[model samples]
Target: MRSALALGPGAEFDRIRSILGRLGERAAGVGGDCALIPAGDGQLAVSVDLSVEGTHFRTEWLSLEEIGWRAAAGALSDLAAAGAEAVGILASIGVPRGAPASAVTTLMDGVGAAAASVGGVVLGGDLAAAPTWLVDVTVIGRVEVPVTRGGARPGDGVWVSGRLGAARAALDALVRGATPDPEAREAFAKPRPRLGLGRALSRLGVTAMIDLSDGLGGDAGHLAAASACAIEIDLGLVPIGPGVVEEAARRSDPPAVYAAAGGEDYELLFTLPEAASLERVRAVATATGVPVTRIGRVGEGGGVHLRLDGREQEIHGFDHFA
Candidate 1:
């Protein structure tokens, strides 16, 4: 498989198409770029994301399978944020000239696996040549009531669906030429988008939501800006993932720093009105088996504020053009 993937472009592409055709047989709603089907009564939600070699991932640091899984998971996380049920995904790939056929197939296989995990399938896609490997995934979802980042209001409580920082910590370890803890590596390589949790929150009338792709602080700022509200996060309330605290200790950095500013966790961050019942929240958490934590509240102004031991702290996550 490794040797096959190292082959030249022409043969690699042919092999890729063959594999895709077989995989598409079991995946419904797959045909062309545009999928024609019956429109549901609910609203349709669509999101697109791109993952590139050297930028979003490093081939030297991760297996092709891991890279593929991360790319698809990141794209689907958007659907999870909107509280929508995924319908299908369209993948577009840019393969470097000398890249292996096996690698491309593995990448698509990862994409297919992620789609199935979210009760979706690969509808169709396009392929092209590029200087570096790239994968672009577009997700289509349906929702009775679409959640948006702009819906947060004053007095609303901020919440997160799962722990944070493991993904960032894994990246940090890789950048430093060290192997990450197994749990942290798994968190980065195979993030599970909170699709079920999003649907439950939507049903429970969540006001605003966003996936924790760009870290808690930066993503929270996005929600605040969109909703024209201020958000204050209690650092102590942030759920740091396992191994993160130890990693922080090893680096002599505060554990809260990673929870606040680490990126690519793929967890859901949302808001609910103050009047929302804690009982209902607990029920949802119990039903979904996904931990839900209240980290802060929506306030009267705009921007995200982090409070550490009652003092304000400044933190931000990843930015492509920064």
Candidate 2:
């Protein structure tokens, strides 16, 4: 298996950011300080993500459209973490020599569609040869309503934009040699994040939010630890994707486990004042055509706990280091 760094979205970009000071333009750097550009008195929020063939997804399981959609959506997802309105993208693709031309076209189409879905587009890209297919995207976005992890308060209600564990379920089924049901397969192949909802949450008075690409358990931990608040999720209320229940039964894995530890769900984990009206948030989601649900709340201390039908489950999520 490839290590995280070799796979996708694993490189520690900060070290490289500081190192780039030694080099000049061209490496003029992920917009190098263009993100520093003024934004009509709003804060600039930038994020980038990469995806690789074997590590991120295997070609055997995903269709051409699925890979393309995931490539762009993954990067946009990071932007969502910051509650930013994405404007556009810069893409770089590393394709192995002798790869078919049709494959490239298909993947690029996916990128275009995904970006368009988010009200963003790819300005351009750099293509090169590598041993595997690699897609990297640098997303430029703006935050009119900053929703970082630092703002969670004790009484904040915890919520997610959509279902959990779908993508993970899709990928795990492939890994275990079990055929995924149509819904499970779709979750992994073409995961969709709640786009307008992230920014809408900001307008609706959200304090902190993150998309559930990394799994609810660890992602919640991120919001809690960063906000210095405690987080406890009610497993019973977790919104699950279609076909997850029957799929888990077929695979002999705990359905709840899939909901908690599963990666690539692309749902949002956000905090709002407990007293704030969810009517507007729901209305906006309905207007913008996405589904969202409040699942938990932040507390006084910084820690993570999971209570399921009154039984506690161990915390779970992606652990790149482990």
Candidate 3:
């Protein structure tokens, strides 16, 4: 448990490089300022995410390893939303004084592990000193047909991949100093980006796509705004994860609140053209092993609305400034 201050900068950098090298084939040909990859005729997709201590996460609630994985996954989720296959990740981290070198090693290991899970490699990064731990990851990916938020047209079907609210439930439990179900804990610590499902949807000709990092309500509003179309979400059609209902019921809180507004789900939310058949959607779901649920439709106009049992309901998800 030697402090980073004792290890100095050069030794720490070497340690990181050594850890990344152990990724084997995943880390092949990764070095220098950038990693090289063959683009062919397809387009390259890039996205960056920043995770800060105390703001985006609490070290007390999550281990250094979990924090690393969560941060890397957050960045990779953006590439998934673009219907891209991840190529590699560049992680720039700031370590605080008195931080243990072992902790930092665990963090890098987590990052490499997450990247390897999605066929991604750890290419290169920068390290610096800071007052608090900071993690920023830039993910590079490739997409033959890039899906965007502005592609949804009026009369298209709105769909979501996988269930929601488990991450929010885990956060709530941690804040209350209570332990949540294993599924909820995993959802918070290691969210699976729907990369396979996103690729399949792109091949299926999906109109628009986005990842559910900022909760369904807010993220759906983003898609609606970008497309200049109104989105009507049927709460009844939304899939609620296990334990969410019981937790909400016990607290006298409506489960729909979490289902609609909980953040960090990292699931894929997309829209398909009116001509897209349910059978086709089901086929993609079967192929990717990711469940797809149709919860609403795109309509003319702009904004996002919620419907519960045919009644219009008001709801909003996470907003960093609000």
lDDT by residue (1-322, candidate 1, tens digit) is 2211221123323464456567655543321111223356776677777999999998887887777778888988888888888888999989999888887898899898999999999999988989988999988888776777778999999999889999988888888898898899899889998889999999999999889887888778767766778988999999998668877887777798766788899999899999999999999999999999999999998888899899898887677645
| lDDT scores in order | 0.81, 0.72, 0.81
TM-score of each: 0.86, 0.85, 0.86
Can you rank all candidates by TM-score, best first? 1, 3, 2
Q: Between which residue pairs do clashes occur in model 3? A: none
- Write candidate 3's Cα lDDT for 206-310 as tens digits: 988889887888778778766778988898899997668866776776787667878899999999988998898999999988899999999988888888878
Candidate 1 regions exceeding 4 Å error are: 1-40
Q: What is the full ranking by lDDT, best candidate first?
A: 1, 3, 2
Q: What is the overall TM-score of model 3 with all chains considered together?
A: 0.86
| lDDT at 297, model 2 | 80
Candidate 1, 311: how far from true, in Å?
Answer: 1.0
Report the C-alpha displacement of residue 127, candidate 1, in angstroms.
1.7
Worst 10 residues of 3 by lDDT: 1-10
